[model samples]
Target: MRWPFRIAMSTTAVMLFDQAVFAGQFLAGTFGALHTHRANATYSGIAVLVAAAAAVPLRWPGRGPLWPVLACLGLFGLIALQIVLGFQRLLTVHVPLGVAIIGLAAGLAVWSWRPDRVAA
Candidate 1:
């Protein structure tokens, strides 16, 4: 129980940090610093993988934080797909997926800090 909540908060922090870095990447692209794109994508993929892995321990006994864990996994899947769509310049799916990731990650971040939420 304690582990899930702690891991959730930790991963949520990663999501928050990733969002910030994502915004910076946008800025970099705007200024023609395109070199950071691949680097950013690499780090973003790594962060998503780490978050997904952290979510595994959340499935221990008790109420089972299923949806959050699934969401993290789903986010990772969408990101992988997003990368492909992006590489193909399929802006239609890629853009919407990016927005979804932002909203989901932000929601998780806020949910993690809820005072009423208990670990045990």
Candidate 2:
């Protein structure tokens, strides 16, 4: 269960990083990159949802803390809002929110790998 959660978190973090790369390419005048970015945003959102699902068993049986579950849910909500902002071309909020999403995803991945902390 822990390993599954760790993998999910790591995958989500990587997806978020790829999202950033695509965004940068789009900003650099690559029109096709915007399409890729939008597609990856959906994938990233799915990945976060998967991570959240994985986080459930970690806490349900009292094998771990509940923060990861809550964090993943919160992150997913932010990603949902992010997609809306991007579609609206609201860069003022979208840009910073994207950064925060990546940070949170990466932090969760890192935390998932910490055996002691994950089980606590």
Please give, for residues 1-112, the per-residue lDDT of candidate 1 as tens digits. 4455555545655654564466466776654333455456556666656665665655654455777677777767776787788689887886777777667776765665
- The TM-score of candidate 2 is 0.93
Off by over 4 Å in 2: 117-120
Among all candidates shown, the one with the greatest TM-score: 2
Which 10 consecutive residues of model 1 have the lowest summed lDDT?
30-39
lDDT of 2 at 37: 95
lDDT of 1 at 39: 53
Candidate 1 segments whose C-alpha is farther than 4 A from its true place: 1-32, 61-63, 116-120
Per-candidate RMSD vs. true structure?
Answer: 3.9, 1.9
Report the lDDT of model 1 for residue 16: 40
